[model samples]
Target: MAQDESLRDLYDGCYRRLVAQLYAICGNLGEAEDAVQEAFVRAVEKPRRFAQVDNPEAWLRTVALNVVRRRFRRLTRYRGLLRTAAASTPADAVPGLSPDHVTLVAALRQLPLEQREAITLHHIVDLPVREVALQLGVPEGTVKARLARGRARLAPLVREFAEDVEEVDHV
Candidate 1:
């Protein structure tokens, strides 16, 4: 009973923030919510272990991030095997997100998963490079390289977006 109550409190406090973080990482709201929810469910399945954690929220975030990564890997494999099958796209943009936000996320989806993770954590989530490295379990130099590569890939897309905005303003 106590474990359940504490877990409930943690969920109420961290759910939205985790979802937003994961959404930025994954570029899809539904997948983000599902990942976070899966993390909580895992906590419920191992209450004693969860209670032993010193930083429950961080632990939850790690679990959710792992869930997202695993799903992406599995999906990639599935897609590779189904190359001849029709590709499905997300049905619509998330409501309440701006057009620029949508465009940026679409561009982000083009990045390799590692680079996308680094860029999202460092830039979108505003974590320091050291912290991003820690979260990703990569060396600082690797994180730096990923960030550089991601930025290089995104530069043209962002410049095009800016040009479109400028043209719209001029008209």
Candidate 2:
């Protein structure tokens, strides 16, 4: 296939899934969309030696994962600056999130990054364990382990939230 056709095919096939994957990792729709777009740009800039790869979907997933990771790292480093900038300017501030959403996000933030990534990819994005393993470049067992542990950790947090709600109801 010609380069344009190949790129088009890759984009059509992978864009939605890649965006979904990134969203699961980042927990922010806008950031996920941006990361996927950046990944596509990078892929187009230097076409992968596609002839050597058996599964292009897997390759695209790997690239997308790397893009998200890099973006996350960059965001971490500049978070202070970003916070300061946001504080100084009310123009771009996002509206407040629901308390339930905020609580869930805070719980997710407490998870180890790998466990959180695996849980989100599996539960939120509905990706199969095998596909998530491939995307994360880990063994299937590792993905399973992470998912199990993450769920175990989250269960109590959710229960605690529920208990707090019940207590509030009685007060």
Candidate 3:
């Protein structure tokens, strides 16, 4: 009964202030309120633990902040997926990307899957050869060989494409 009263007192005393602080951090009144409410629900779910906290308000604030951060991260990932799915072509997928980047992507598609993966991870994704090998579950030497072959195949294709672009520009 005392624990329940303490929790009730904490809620009545801190709810509005916590929501205001969260609103300032999140810039959305609804989200801030929801996060603070969720924190209180969590506290109710663990009354004994909540009672043990030295600063219940700070604990609730941290929980609310974590909730906000998690939602932000999830929303960011969702938006990235939406952007990727909305574009039909690679060039259309990322605006402001250079022509060379588009050309590189097209050239990458022409390589065999293994070589393409190796080159993309090592050069484009900027992972080291060892890291690429680990990700691909292959030997470092294999990744190196794939990168070498991929680069060999791409050089001619890229050079020819660049020459064509240069001629067009000149005309």
Candidate 2 lDDT trough over 10 residues, lowest sum: 85-94
Candidates 1 and 3 compared: the better one by TM-score is: 1
- C-alpha local distance difference test of each model: 0.86, 0.73, 0.74
Cα RMSDs, all models: 2.1, 5.4, 15.6
Instruction: Show pairs that collide, candidate 1.
Output: none
**What lDDT score goes with residue 93 in model 1?**
52
Best by lDDT: 1
Better of 1 and 2 by TM-score: 1
Q: How good is model 2 by TM-score?
A: 0.64
Residue pairs with colliding backbones in model 2 are: none
lDDT of 3 at 103: 68
lDDT of 1 by residue, 1-171 (tens): 887899999999999888877887788899999999999999999999999999888788889999999999888888789886434355245887777777787778778888888888888778899988888889999999999999999899889878988999999
Q: Rank candidates, TM-score, best first.
A: 1, 2, 3
166 in model 3: Cα distance from truth in Å? 53
